[model samples]
Structures are given as C-alpha cells and as structure tokens.
Target: MEYLKVEEGDQREPVSPTGQFLNSEALSLCILGVLELGVPISIDESHMDSLVKDVFLPTNPRFSSIMVEDENGEKLWKRVKVKIKDHIKTPTFPSGLSPKIYDKYIDDYISDIATEKLPVTRPLWQIHLINYPTSNSNAASSMIFKIHHSIGDGFSLIGVLLSCLQRADDPSLPLTFPSVPLSSTNKDSNGLFKKVSRIFSVVTNTVSDFYTSIVWSSLLEDDMSPIRSGVAGVEFRPFSVATVTFSLDHIKQIKSNIGAKTVRVQAKQIQLHWCCSTRGNFAVMFPIKEMIKLDSKTPWGNYFAFLHVPLPKLTDDDSTSYSNPLEFVWKTREIINAKKSSLGVYLTGRLLQVLKILRGPEAAARYIHGTIKNVSMGITNLMGPVEPMTLADHPVTGLYFMSVGAPHSLVTTIMSYNGQLRIAIGAEKGLIDAQKLKSCIEDAFQTILKAACDDDT
Candidate 1:
C-alpha cells in the first residue's frame, strides 16, 4: 500500500469511506466491452492511442493515477504520468480465426482479465483492443479494462462512458437519454393505505416476515447447488467470464404470457428482498452482508452495494414439471411471491447502522465482509440502448462487461443490446466451466421459447 516514487504535480485525495471499505479486501471491478464495427473500416492504432491520451485522459485525470496508502495509513490517490503504450494495448488475432475461434479467444481474454488486479504503480484502468473479426462484425474489436472497485460502481462507470461520447452522427450535439422515470411516486398518491392501515400492516406483515428471515438465515443456507460453494467452500477463488445471447422479443413474449410485471411488482411490494449481484438476482433468505451505503453524492467513484443471488439448478428434474419455457421463472415467482410482503430489505439497511452503533465502524465493515464470503455465484441483467452507438465515427454493435472479484468466484452479467439480450457469466475457472454454465442458461431460455403459451399463464 506504500506509494511508488513520487511523481511531479501529483495530488493525493483520501479514498472515500466506501473505497476504504472495499480496499480492505483488495477487490477491483473490471469492465470488458466488445465493440462491433460493421463491414470493413480502417482504424489507426495511433489515432486510437491519441484519442485516449488527449480526449479520455484529459476528461478524467484520475484515470492517470494510482491508489496507495499514505504515511498515516490512509488510502489516498496520487496522479502519475499517463503512459499511452502501457494503458492502451493492441492484441492481434490470426488472419483466419473463424468466428468460433475468435469467440474462444475473446472468452479466454475476458477470463484472463477478470482475474487480474489493477497495479498500484499505474492508472487504475487499462484498455486491451483486439483487431479481429467478430461474429457480429468484421471491423469489430474488444476493449477490456481493469478498474478498481473503489473507483466507481456500474452507474458511475456508465455515466463516465456516456460523458466521453457525443451523438455519433453529429459530434457537436450532446448525447441525450429519453427521460423515463424508473421508480414510481409515493404510495400516498395511490390513496391506498392510511397511517393506521400502514401501521397495522407493518406490525402484522412486516414484523412477522422479518422474524421469519432471521429464523431462516440463522438455521440454513439457501439451497446448496453447483454454483453455490456453501460456508465451507473456498472463499477466495479466481474468476472467469461466460456468455449467452437470448432473443429480446422471446423474453417479452414470456413476460406477456405470465403477467411478469405483476409478478415482479408484487414480489417487490410484498415479502420481497429482491436484489442483484454482478451476475444475477434472487431472494436472499440469509444474513445481511456487504451492501453499498448512501454515498452517491460524489461525481464519480464506487458507491454501491453487493447482493449475491445464487443460481438455481437448471437440470433438476423437479424443476421441469411445467411445460412452458418460462417454467423456471414462474416457479421462482411462486417462491418469491410468498415473501413479497417481507421487510427483509428494510431490515438489511438497518443492519450496518445497528452494528456501527454496537461494535464500531471497523467491526461493522468486517461483519459486512464476512457475511458476503458465503455467497458463491452472482447474476446481473443490464438493459442497454435499442439502437447502435458509435465511438470515434465507428458504430458500436455489441457491448458487455463483468465484475472481477467479490469474494465469490462466479459472477453473471446480462445486457440487452439491439434485438438481443447478451448474458455474460463470470466464474472461477477450475470451480466451474464458463461454457457449461452458458449452455445451461441458453438451454433453459430456449426451452421456454419453444413451449406454447398456456392460457393459465
């Protein structure tokens, strides 16, 4: 954690409380993106280098720095001279890598990058660009960077990516997003539950579920499957990336067939504690662990929570009773529906406060780290732009990313781009085969797509 040789004009800023919390475990968030450039287009490696050096480096000077502990043992950031060659790497693929071979190279590249920790001697990020033919495009290439988790969370990182970009067509025009409100208004607007009714519901429903969750976590673990390593499993394992692509229209069809909105909303309002991991989401019928705190006031840096949701055993015969492809989803809906009214998430938020009060902040942070160690696999679903995006005049066709480490070996990331929803799976190499997991997910999704829409759904 000591500083490397001091550099000129280097300024040190104390790592935020959240950053300190993550630094305790030396975890980093690595973002891997696959950019699709359609047809054949000439790309100068020097131009790409200059673009990052002049545009990207100036836009975020912090990217030209490293994280180190100062004399007082405080986590601090110090600026360093930007090294274009060290930061932007150009990897070449064979002349005839056939789409499949190229894909394998990509998988290997991601897996290798996912296991790499950012060096404290250089900037916290690095981009690896490969001039190769992608299954989606010929001029396409991939850029994978290792970012310290302390640097920022997904939301902030996405913001940074958008900030550097303007409307592809007109560089002068700023990129704008349609203002669509994500969350709903206050419950009072519904004119539904009065104060007295709310009190009664909280006392009866919320209190009861909180007590039940306590009993559950204290007693047993959420099913022990291939993906879940259980309490005794190896906690510190390396990670890898796996990917699967599904039809966006087909997913919507499944949603229509089964009032999926009603299912998710009902689950959220009722006994639900629905949360997501770098991989995916599910009910956390366990103890509270590491969750991001309310510290998003900063312009950019990681201020996020960690929710580890286990993957269900897709090959289990017991889960195949229903004929619909969405049987897994419907079955999951039923399981979560029962606990929709629970106050688990609310109680979880209070856990750190209670611990900080009784045991101290350091103790509370340790408790957070300890609780997340038992988690084995993670799942994430990301929604992206319906239309393609261009970077430096080249259209970006496909994009993807993955979280490097979280004490858990397996992490799953899903992003829907254009007409397809691409699911990227990250797991420890020896612990689980990324290819097998991808196959399982694809098979399950296809099974649902091939089934008929039942009237009951």
Candidate 2:
C-alpha cells in the first residue's frame, strides 16, 4: 500500500500492529477507556467547547482522525475535519432530585454508555457533561472522557488529559508527582555460583509460566465462582462501576508499620488477599500487562501485552487465620519479585507478534480475547499528578477511570492523585454484587491497617 497524504499532509499512516489487533473490522475488539473527573462547580458548555476545539483536537492527531481501510483491508488513520458539537454530550436531569437520586442517575448513565460502541465515521472519542450535584464531596459536576483504546492506553491518555490541565494554584508551573522512592534489591554477589543459580532459576520459571499461559488460553479455565459468570459474550454485557477512595498517608503508615518496602506492594497485597478470601480463588488477570513501551522518537500508539498473575492460595485453616494479616503482604511481595525476575511478559509479546504474522490479526485478536475470556477478573493501576489540577478553569474535586468491554466478570482499576488512591471496580451488572465487592475491599484495608498498628507496638 502506498503511503498517501492529502492536501493536509498530516496523520496518514498505517495503524500499528497492536492497534489493528484492537480495532479491526474483521475482529472488532476495542476497549472503551472511560475517565470520570468530578468538579467543584457546574460545567460551562462554552468553556468545554473551546477546550475540545483548541486544546484536545490539537493535542494528538489520532484524536482528529478516523480509522479507514485501504483496498488490501489494512487499517490506516486518515485525518478528517472534526465537528466539535458532534462529540460533546449534555444529559439533563429532573430539576429537584435529591443528591442520592442524582448519584444513582450518574452511575446508571455511565453503565449505559459503557455498553455502546463508538462510531467509526468520526474520531473515536466523546465528552459527556453531567451538571448535577453528586454525593461525592462537593462535586457539583462530573466530566466523562470516552476514548477508544486504539488511540492509547490509560497511561498515555492520562498524559493527553494532563496536557489540558494545569496547576489550579498556578497555571504557569508544571504538574509533579510525589517523590516516592523506587525500591531495588542489592544484586552484589561474592561468587559465580549465585549468579549461575539465578540464571538457571529464571530460565526454569519462564518455561513454566509460558506453558501455563498456553494451557489457560486453550484447555483450562477458572472455575465458576461468585465473580466468574462463565457466560458467552460477556464483553457486551452491561457492567456496574463503583469507586472507593483511601488516604495515601494511611497506606504509607501501613507500609511503615509492617516494614514493607513500597506502598504499592502494601496496597496490592490488601487487594490480592481480599479477592482470595471474599470472592474466590482466582488468578488476577492483566489484559495488557506492559501497557506502554514508549520510544522517544515515535508517536504514542497501542503497545500492550498480557500476563496472568495468580493470587496466593489459602486452605480452609489458612482462610480462617486472620491474626497475622501481614503474611499476605509478605506473600504478595515474594510473588511480584519472582515475576520481575522472569521473562514471561516479553515472551508473550513475541508470541503475539508471530501469531499476527502467520495467522493474521483476527486470529491474534481471538487469542487475546481467549486469554481475557478464560480469566475471572482483571486489574490495572495508573499514577496521576501530585498537585491539584484544573480543567477549563474549573477545579477537579475527584478523578477515577475504568476499562469497559472487557470479557470478564470483574475488572478493577486504580489511580493515585493528589494524596489519595481511587479504586474503581467494574463488575458484571446482574451477576456480581458490586456494592458487596466494595465492602469486602474496604474490610481488607481495615484488617491490614489494624494488624499493622498492633504489631508496631
């Protein structure tokens, strides 16, 4: 196919391999990435209109282009003239509804949109404004950004969102993140014996993990539990979204009390253990383990792979043993460290590339879908700026995001902003109890925090 450019010589390139895997007409496997931001004041449509036309469309050419196929049926991004009004939505509510009713309306509104597919005629994105008082703090308005996963993952999309935001206190200054020190282990060894042993261990573990991935994708699947609906076409099914916020300072205290190396480990430890106890024994699946691999010279696109991280198993006695909850933290740390030492994630990426070359993208998409379909649940996390941010001159009161159209019973997305972590749980609407899941996660956090405090003394 010829690389053609029109009068406007911009954004006429073939879609990346991963992008095709996500958004091909033959196998339309798209992840509708939705981000919800709460604002302290009511939304101004005029300000948002200007932002969409000036700031957003100009930030990335992908935001202004539509995916089209050539004679050979290969997807290419073609620039198009965007109509700002076509992409903006404003839903009205009753005049005198209470805050509680408005909250329910907001949740129902999000689920309604989550199940709908984005049209291919225009740019694959939209913005929704809900100018109603929500029960979450002083959030009188909520802004929803719906973008296709083909444009970018949560990480790069967050960057695009950041481009539209500035420090609420000083728009002249740049946004920053908390100085959380990265944890690393000493690799110094006195003899060749330890080095050789480490290499052998990594090789053995990689082989085992690769084999497990193959089996799980084909023959074996998670058992039918409360969270696993085991239904066909679960991706198209509606899912409920719920959010729970935790103080970063309290998480740090839990880490300090238990002598944990990093706050991330402590936070995930609570979640992994909670899933094992409250829901069922299921491996926590990541549809795209390595979400973004940025090349300094190339523009951002879909660059994601998959991984299956199993939750630590518990026996009947172990399930009842809650006196020492710190063991959960220790076990999770060990499992993560072992995963870091292996090459399973890289191998999975290579395998997908080979499949794309030999069998074609539809097969590759099916393989990817099967990997996600067999799993009971999925989880992903992202980091936000440390300081307060504003969008179109309105202060953001809260921020959280969730991935829709995933073929699973449950998917949890976490993001940290300012000084708190927001955990958004997306679960199958009729099959899973989202509120009960939220309560169980909260219980896990409190259990760990209490145990840490008692042990510190």
Candidate 3:
C-alpha cells in the first residue's frame, strides 16, 4: 500500500460532529477499503478529479489545523500537512487466477487501507475504481468506493455523492455542488468564558438527553429475558447461512396484527424470529430505538443501544414461521423495555468510561477487537425509501451496506432502497462457511418473499 501526504497550508474542514460520529471508526475503515479499490473501476476522470480536488482543499476550520499551545502558552489551531502518492500501476496480484481470486484482491486491499494512517493535511477520504471479474457475461467488471470515517458518516457521505450525480441520460449537464453552511457559532473569538460555557452546555444536554432516552425506553415496552452464557468453546463462523426479507406490505401487516399502536412492533417480530430460528447461541437481535427519541437535544446520528433478544431452544419438530416467531419477538421487546430506565444510558456511559481509561487510539482499537464476539450480529431497518443512488451514470439496480464483521462470526445489514428491501451479510472467514451462509440467506429471503407474495394475493 502507498501513502500520500497532503501539502502544508492547504485549507479543508472536518465534517460536523454528527457527521464525524457517523464517519468515525467503522465507517472510516470501510471507506478506506473502497477507495483503495478505485484504481481499476469505471469512474469518470472528472468525477475522480472533483473528489480529490474538492475534498482535499482547505476549509473554514482547516481540517489540517489541530489545536495546540505555543511556547508562550497562547493556544491556536496548528496546521499540519502531508503528501499523497499516485495510484500504483504495478500488479498487486499474482499472474494467474486462482479459486476465490476476487477475495484475494479485495482482502489484500482491505488490509492495506486498514493500516494506512489518515493524512493530517487533506480531508481523510480516497476513491478507487475496482476492475474485477463479475458473473455477468455481458459486463466484465464492478466498481467499489472507499472513504475515510473522519470525512463523513455513511449517510452524510452517501448524500454528498448522490448530490454530485444526475440520472444517466441527464449526465451531460454539470452537477451542482452544494456548500455546507457554517454553524452559527463563531470559532475565532478569543472569549474564554464563551468557549467554556459552550462546552458545558453541550455536555449538560448530552447527559440530559441520554437520561431521557432511558426513561422513555423503560416506560415504553417489555421483552423477554435473554439467554445466559454457557461454557461451550466458540467455533469460528462465516457469513450467515440464512436471511429473510419482508416486503413493506408484509411488515405493515405484521405491525397491524401485533399492535397497530407503534411501528416498533414489526422490528420486535423480526428480532424475535431470528433469535428463535437460530437458537440463542447463533445471535441476538436488538432494536435500535435511538431514532425514535429524536428531539432538539438528541444526537443527530446513531446513539442507540442493542438490547439482546434471547432465543428459546427449538425442539426437533419445531417449525420456524412468521406466526410462531412472535413469541420470541415479545420477549426481546421486554428486555428492551426493562432497560428503558436510566440503566441503559448508565450502562452505556460505563462502557464509554472504560473505553476512556484505555488511553490512546491503540487502546480504542483493542477495545473494538475485544468487544465483537459478545454479540453475533446487528440489523438496522429504516422506515422509508432511501434517496435513489447511481454510479457512473447508471442507476444503481440494488445496494446494501454491511460493516466488516467484528471478531464475531457474522453481521447482517438490511436497508430499504427505492421500494425494495436489500440485505447484506458479513462474516469472518473461518467461523462460518461463506457458501453455506449465502445459501442460508438466499433460502431465508426466498421464504420471506414467497410468504409476502401469498399474503398479498
């Protein structure tokens, strides 16, 4: 892997706090990987140039500027710069093709991006066009995009890219780039009292909002208890063996049947079904409730907790179906409700406190690695149609995003694009067999699709 430094004195700004949180660690890792794959992809020269040029230039806050004190004790945002390397032309892969060749290329690039440091000089993002073999006989390739977590969170980055693109046929017109509006607060002012007051206000609000979330979650609902841990030596796992997709109508029906009072009922059922079907050992389902508590004070991005839904052991003749899954669903709901009191935020704060004590980024890195295995997977469902997405003038047929799996065997990601729900599952290499997981996911999706179709008819 090659490293590029951004030139000193160039100005560029960091994204907002919400954007920073979203673009933070996990998202950043994925972006870096995608950017490394950009070399061989079909990106237009102009688009690529715009990405590098617009993204790297100086900003109001000057992203390269880090706050520090001078010898005389005056404090200021010190600007630092670094250089960037051109794309490597030499073949990073071996001469002949082998089994799972795509995996080799992708994995090698992933590792390279993961280890590379973000340049302090420019905005921390990269774009790489991947030229890779695909199953389609008509088209020989595919494209991947890599971005840094510090640049923007997933949604923010998606929004940024989408803004730059037009429909394929309309691509001839120059796309308009939207400038991010400045925050109301002034950063250059030398008033120490104002700065301190702002910091205090932010902390106070965050703490208050966190407590409020706990109260709402607690008073809101109840779920079943989760399974206790056992001593079984964990086996290495790979991608999911099965996945199921529910149509919008089907999900709505489930909500109507369960409790028409709240949209969360459907989420409850999905989590319950997965927990019971896989047995408690396979994974736990958590409903992300952070979005529901949105208020003026609440954080803008993800601040939800995963309330573990424990599955009951299935008997030999047990049939896993949508109706039966409701039992497990309600149980998980109870767990979520139980923690709705201050306990949820308290626990989270405690965890964050532990993380803080670790000291330094390396400690944070270790913390993430150690925590992945405690849960089997995560699933997020957004209620509405996502804004349409396209690439190189071609409307995207489908898209799904999954974080690279933690130490855990697998993670499943689901989102609705256009009118269709898309799912992507990630798993570790040795733990779960990829083919088996793929088959299982396909089977699950088919089952759900068929069930939805029948219900519609």
Candidate 4:
C-alpha cells in the first residue's frame, strides 16, 4: 500500500488507502467489464508493438492510478499498467465469431475478474488479442480491452484508446501519446501521515465551503420544488421490457425541438411513455421529480423515486400506427413537463428504517451482500461524438461499449461517437438471448431514425 504525491492545485486531495466505492455508473462499468470485439482486420507484430507502446502507454492513467498524499502533502498522479491476456482459439462467425459465443466469453471473463482489490503490480488495464481458428479453418483475430474505473470516465477512456491510431496507411507519423508523469515510491512514513493530514484538511474545508455557500444562496434561490403529480392513483402492472434507439441526428433534433439542456428530459420522456402505455411500475427515475420539493425537508443527497405509470388498456378500435407512436411520445413528454412544474415531495423516511437495520455490523454485511440478488437495469446515454478516435493505424469503423450491473437482469448503455450510435446490453446468463436483444435494439434505433428522417422528407 504505497502512496503517490499529489501535484499542486489538483482538485482531488490525497486520501489514505486510495480506492473509493464507485460513485458513477460510467466509472463502475469501466472497472467491472472488458471490451471484447472481433476485428476482421489484422496487423503485424511491429504494428501491434507500436499500438501498445504509443496508445496503451500514454493513456494508462485513466484507469490505473489512485490519488495519494506525500509527506509534504502535495498532489500527484500515479499510473497503473494495463494487463494483457492471450487466448488462442478458432473463430466461427463472419464477423469472426458468433455473437452468442462471444457474449458467453465475455460473461465468463467478467465473472473471473471482477473484484475490489486493485492490482498493485501493473497498469490497471488489460488487453487480450485472440488469434483463433475460423469455422473455415482459417485464423481470425479479436481484441479485448479491460480497464479499471478510477482512472477516468467511459468517454475519456475511449478517447485515450482512439488516440493510438493513425490513418490506415499512415503509420509512419510520429505517435502523439498523452503526456503522463512518472510513478514515484512513498519512501517514508511521514509521507503517509502528511497525505492523511492533507486529506483531512481538504475534506473539512470542502464541507465548510459547501455549508456556507448553501446557507447564503438559500436567501435568494426560488422554490422550484419537484412536483409529484402524474397519472398516478392508478393500479400498477408489470410490463414487458422493450428498447429503441434513435440516430444521433434525430436525437439532436428532438433535443432541439424540446429545448432541453440535459439527458434527464429524454429519460423522463421514456419513463412517462412507458408508464402511460403499460401502466407499469418503475424501479427508479433520475432528476427525481421530488428532489426539488424535498431538498430543504430531507437530507441533501440523491433523492430519486419510483412510481407506477399506468397505461390505458387498448381497445379493438385502436390502431397501431406512426401517428399513434408520435402521439404517445408527445403525450409522455407533456406529462413529464407538467410534473416538473408542480412541486412534490418523495417519501425518504424508509431510508431511516434501512439505516437502523444497517446499524449492526452483521446486518450491514447482510444488506450489502443482498445487493447481489437485487439487480436492476440502468440506462445511461452518452450522447454524440465529442471527438474522433482511431486504432491500429486504421480509422475506426464502429465502436460499442457496455457495463454489467448487479443482480444482472439487464443493463443498457448507449453512446454515440464519430457518426456511429452504439448500444450494449448486459443480461443474466440463460435469462436473455443477447443476439435477439441486440437485433431488437438495432431495429428500435432504425425505427426512430426512419421516423426522424421521414419528418425531414
């Protein structure tokens, strides 16, 4: 358990024992799963060497290092080495292997690797290049990207990876590796103490600053509280899960049309429509409609809520058409907006009940362990191309990434980068046909794209 020096003026202060519980979905997913893809393209050893040396080396910190204190209490960054694993096998699908088999491989790999202990010896990333047999008895290649979460968010990690490529034939260009500082050893006990002291001081200051700011701002802020009103007072029912995707352009257009600033609006529309159509219960909703109202009455923590969105039963005279879909989507957006305007409080008194049970050590352990059984799907959309990325000197054709959540029912991740919109869905073993889900999601995205494009026509 060595510590690293913090660089001056860095926002993150050094902490003892370094690692913290993942607080964001993007970070958690990067740490929890590997990116496995089959590449129809191949390169020589020198090219692979260049990719690893230039691309992998410089971007190592996004997943490898922890912030720690030095004896003097200055901030610094530590770099972790990414791990590489090799498995030689035969390929089967035209894309190099069948999606079903590839997904199974991913499941097994994640089960084997997910853990809390941060690797101390190498960079916190791994690469596996599989050169295996094809169904045609010819060799095919695949690449696996395994990175830890603490280093950077999903977007940043992907950016680092893409930085490794040049144009397909322009490998001769000098590599532009992201600059990183060298790793330094903790040398003495005083260094550790100083780091701890600095961390304590920083935490104290932060709490004080937050308290003062909030107190002063309270005098001038308006009471735009969250409203709890919706098509409530209706019975809730279980609904079947379905997914849809929209082209990046259409998503942008919708955002522009709605004049929304954040993805919360989009997510709310989805929740509203699903509730209206199926009258089903939702486990959770973000930008909780209740948070605004209850901020002063409750603890200032994330206070989301779950409710049932009841749908009207379909009549024989009702027809499913493009008009119907548009109407449903529009109505859902309206309901969400109406709820947003009226303040409503979410009941969080249950949390006290949970805390009471968790007061005991045994009970706390039991509760934490129980999370393994209570998995729920989470949807996170990383909208649009922030930047371009390449790999192995080849322009990226397409990119997709996903993370597996606990209880493992299904977790959907959507990201649009470089003119491509990608979706990755994780499911429990034997619970979902990954191929079918993939197709459904693709179809959904296509449907949305067509609708948007048709509007243009």
Candidate 1 lDDT over residue span 321-435, tens digit each: 6334455566566545544445545675466557656865455556555445444454443345555567777677666666555545556566556666766666666767777
10 residues in a row with least lDDT, candidate 2? 289-298
Error of 2 at 167 (Å): 0.9
Q: What is the total number of backbone clashes in candidate 1?
A: 21
Off by over 4 Å in 2: 1-11, 25-46, 180-187, 275-299, 319-322
- Arrange candidates by lDDT, highest first: which order? 2, 1, 3, 4
Candidate with more favorable, higher lDDT: 1 or 3: 1
Candidate 1 deviation (Cα RMSD): 6.3
Off by more than 4 A, model 1: 1-10, 39-42, 92-94, 136-139, 166-224, 229-240, 262-299, 308-327, 334-369, 450-452
Q: Output the TM-score of candidate 3.
A: 0.55
Candidate 1, 195: how far from true, in Å?
6.0
Displacement of residue 109 (Cα, Å) in model 4 is 4.7
RMSD (Cα, Å) of candidate 2?
Answer: 3.8
lDDT of 2 at 111: 83
Model 4 lDDT per residue over 53-156, tens place: 66566554333344455556332445434343321212333345664454455445544443233343444566555443222112233455556544544444
Q: What TM-score does structure 2 among the candidates reach?
A: 0.90
lDDT of 2 by residue, 1-457 (tens): 1222333345578788877777653334334333334544354667767878888887788998888776676678998898888898888888788877887888888888877778788888888877887776557777788888878766667667777788888998877765557455467763688879889889987887778677787777877777888898887788777778899999999888777777765666777755353323234433342322222232476655566767666667775554477776777778876765777867877888899999988777777777777877887776667888887677777888777777788888777778999888888989988878888889888887887888463
Could you tell which candidate, 1 or 2, scores higher by TM-score? 2
Q: Which tens-of-lDDT digit does each residue in 1-457 have in candidate 3?
A: 1222333453433333323322333322333222111123555566555544454333223233433333432223344552323322222455456425655565555435434544533434444444554222122343444444434334433334444444433555433321223335566754998778766665665565455434322332212123212112222222232223445555556556544334443443353343343433223223333222212232223233334333444554555432444444455555444433223444543554465455533343333333333444444443322344345454554444444423344455555544445444454444455456556555543444345345442
User: What is candidate 4's TM-score against the reference?
Assistant: 0.49
Give the true-structure RMSD of model 4.
16.0
- Per-model TM values vs. the true structure: 0.75, 0.90, 0.55, 0.49
